[model samples]
Target: MEQDLWSVEFTSLADAIRSGRVTSTELTELMLARIAAFDGRLHSYIAVAPDLARAAARAADAEIAQGHWRGPLHGVPMAVKDVFYTKDIRTGFGSSIYDDFEAPYESTATARLRAAGAVMLGKLTATEGVYAGYHPSITEPVNPFGDEHWTGNSSSGSGVAVTSGLAYGTLGTDTGGSIRLPSACCGLTGIKPTWGRVSRHGVFPLAESLDHVGPMARSARDAAALLGAIAGADPDDPTAASVPVHDYLAQIDAGIAGVTIGIDRDFIAAKATPEVAASIETVIPILEQLGARFVPATFPETREILYGWHTECSVEAALAHRATFPGRRAEYGERLSALLDHGAQVTAFELAEAQRARRAFNGAVAAMFAPIDLFLVPALPVAGPTLAHMATLGPDPDGILAVGPFNAPFDICGYPTITVPCGANGAGIPIAFQLAGKPFSEALLCRAAHAWQGVTDWHRRRPEL
Candidate 1:
């Protein structure tokens, strides 16, 4: 039972905790033990707060015993990316300069999760400034599925921990594909909520306009549950949207019957590997069988749109780090320093032009969604790359132009996007497909993903530790 507990999905695990079938303490300990056993090789965590987690779990167990049930997240054990500020906890932000810097206050997302009765196991590893492809303070997190394979960028440890069962679910920020790319590479379900849909109150920002906070989980249903708990406007974050928050799980099982899904075949053929293309082809028939109708569509030119995103993000990131970069320049990692150097060179006119292009791109995407319920595309162009291959790329180690174009565009448009494991390549590494929807349409996106998971076991498959 203890061994099996690690593999349980978030929803079922919550039910078990509420029903006394499992105690939060038991689950917490199990995960801690797993981390101790496996994380030396995985390097998925920056810190492990076993004492704090145990105390929280005990409190959750007492609350349930007293019949003060919180919700599905009550007594759930999870970890979050180190970018989210946790009060009194050292948040390195994957940099040596901030290695001893502890946050004075908690991020709004972590506070909400705590209120939901979730026990945080610790802080997971992240990239430098949450902008690069690798963590400079710690070893780059290894892919549990394959040692040589990439674990995706920025949210690398969040993906590793969830897939390896070190935690049930985790919060990861996506500026341009940080969340969804990891989900695709790790064979998990991840959602990048509409920009401003989730509060960025205390998160370390990469690109202010494009940053998003969302959940990475083992299944679409779990992602929906996590989104419900943390999403909504916060007075602390002026940019958080003042829109109605829907119950993401309420209609998650609703099938995508009669829903029109648009496919950009030209984009797929141009950017995707043959195996990834084949995996997407395989899922189209499966989705069609589940009653979804497919239609051909064309997206805005990828190069033009992504160039705007890059320019905007680079400039914003440079501004965010201006206090230290170039001044204390030697302190930053090689790749991040290079990026900041590039960002410092961006002219004010270039930033304004990028913003204008972004508005136009968002309009085009919104118009495209007018006729189709969702847009389906390959999440990553190929199976996960090797750390060595990524290293060779230097300053832009993420290879965004190759594996991330499908994801970055949605971030630029602030659209809700979810990536679910569709199938695996010939080597058994997972390949995923993304479903993007209109802004604030996370519930609808999860609904379609949940329906797909109902018929496929891809989301349920676990890596051999």
Candidate 2:
């Protein structure tokens, strides 16, 4: 309404259009102009669907004119990770393998978002297949928090777009923390919804069992609005849950007066870095003030999770691209290429064993949640690594643990995990807290997250860059 469109949350933008303060066309043009002016340096988008977006915006404005606003996303502009099969638009998986591949059909997610009256800005760049960590050859988007720092991979470019104001929100796939990793690194709010809660029909996969498509946004409310638009059962994906969608934004505002939060003493005292430990610990007291309860807990089967996830991820990935990897081994970078080879070598016996272990772990995890409404951990024990280092060799453990082990287990467990910036370290890099929950518990997580956000300004803070 005030024309501070870039800074306004999706909720406010919807209110503006609903009140006749701004038109969808106006916001669409603002985004396009910003993209033209800024994306040359950020490299956030692989493609800009200008004509298509304008048409959608105009259609939305006409709907508003006809007294038929769809909802919160009615005039909001959003983007997707480039790996989605966006009809008539170049939907590359940040790989040279299918660089020219364009889809004749729309993905269920894309089509639904359009039906909800959301406008598409374009396709954001991602790591190869939007799967693994760090793909520099396809795009070189800098993290919006700081140009000097590296954006987290896979959804790296999508993170840049949101933080830099190139787009309001974008869909990102999280296999092992792609969405939460970048959201944490860029100081945004992100949710990796419970597996099967969101559709993956037209999107590319990193791991079939682990991959989750969700929203990354400047605010939790914005994410909830986007989530509402894109979530639901899809006929295209047999795995899509038959659960009915609820008003996520309204749920978030309901607060966490009675939520039971579990803080694992071992994980907090063990795997966390000083920053991560500090960030997560701070959340307990804050949420307590909001009337959320804290319980100390542990996982008896924690030992089996990491190894099983590694075996499962590599194996699934290898099977997915078995034909391509052996023939085009030379095209891939070092880490992923090697992982693919090893994935192919994983025996069926080993996979079966992993599945058995996973069931045991899931049962233990479910038992853990039985005493608590949500579980809290440091999203990753460490902050983002230097792309130069991760690209050349791999991750270097500093003062932090290889904390990514948490992300994989949730994917295997098919539960929901949301990560939000708690605060930044002394160096100004963001630190995140992860909230894990039982299946289809996104509403509970969002409600709690909204309450936490109300007390903290971390979500509202922006980078000087």
Candidate 3:
């Protein structure tokens, strides 16, 4: 197989290397070539570590050449979200405030990726502090999927990198739909594993309790591969879950048989656009043909759950930037500055009410999961809305909520969610269907996503842009 690295999946690349079809150095060089060739137009890469990546890729090549194989992620050419520190890399969280802040050590997630033998393509751009959907203040990485469309933030660059073929996949931190929102916009698959499933040690946090570090990739299978590489308990991150490592890749292709999938119709019905609605409507037969049982349900507290999410994000972000906010409140985007201000003014009583809403909402969602392996909903309310449009909330009153209302509760409740491409809109940008499962039920979630992908062409389609 003489495919360029842009179109290569890491698993396929590794297997080929194992069988002498290709070498890791060749694969890595292909990626480096692609990045060097394409990233100038996309601006997807904030930095390209040619020296470091070649070294790691060469080592992977040497290991395989010597009959030593590291792991599933071994030899994969991947990019890091700037929020996660790579020891020698100049780590900036897309904010000038952190422009020169270099860590003497590495993030646990970064360490894990290194241990798995993954090669870094350097840090990708992000919105300032991973805040708004757009960050022109720093990098101008275009969507490169649909006319420079804004993949929702804060982990904006991760989506751009993956979709633009800058890397096989990239890491992203999610507090409120950062991962899935961009995935939907950029036509990629992203997972916000139940909050603690992955370590947050090296990542800059938006909300400590709500932030999750996960992958955005070309397919659910790829996302699963990357997830397995980095997820586990990290002693440095006290909040990391102490659970059995899931064989995320093995869980795919269970055929969707005997799986009870729930269609959250009310939620789907309310936010879906004509195109998004049609895309999701088309999935019914796909699931039915797979012998999947479908249940229709709704969470009573969906609205309240969202309000609480914003409250939590703002409050936590404000707390983290206590010093910065006071010095130059102008440094933040309008949306974020206003939010942090409101969060600062939030009364204890209001916080308590939001907490109560969160509790009630989590209970409702958990109860909904009682009989279903996954809940399926459109990943975005509308597919790939223009970057300029999403930045200002445009004419859409519902805003990012349209694409990710189901996501925040997943964050608050710490549930597993994977957004896979379902279909594309008229403009040909891909739309997605999200599979959300009970907490730590990623095993079941991956199985169902794998099944869904079996008969669908969504995963096969790529943006022409």
Q: What is candidate 2's lDDT per residue for 30-103, written digit by digit as tens?
A: 88988898898889898898998999889889889899988988888888888788886788788777776778
What ranking emerges by lDDT with the best candidate at the front? 1, 2, 3
Deviation (Å) of 267 in candidate 3: 2.1
Error of 2 at 272 (Å): 1.8
Error of 3 at 101 (Å): 1.0
Which of the predicted structures, 2 or 3, would earn the higher lDDT when compared with the native? 2
**RMSD (Cα, Å) of model 1:** 1.4
Evaluated against the true structure, the overall lDDT of model 2 is 0.79
In model 3, the runs with Cα more than 4 Å from the true position are 1-4, 133-136, 391-403
Worst 10 residues of 2 by lDDT: 392-401
* Whole-model lDDT values for every prediction: 0.88, 0.79, 0.77
Distance from true location, Cα of 158 in model 3, Å: 1.4
lDDT of 1 by residue, 1-465 (tens): 776799878797777788898999999999999999999999999999999999999999999989998998999999999999999567888888887687988999999999999999999988898876553557888888888888898899999999999999999999889999889889999999999999999998998988999999999999999999999989999999989999988888888899999998888989877877887888899899989999988888767767777788888899888888788887888777877787888898988888888788888787878999899998888766666776665435244555577888988888999999987766567789999988888988999999999999999878898
Against the true structure, candidate 2 reaches a TM-score of 0.94
The window of 10 residues in a row where model 1 has the poorest summed lDDT is: 393-402
Best by lDDT: 1
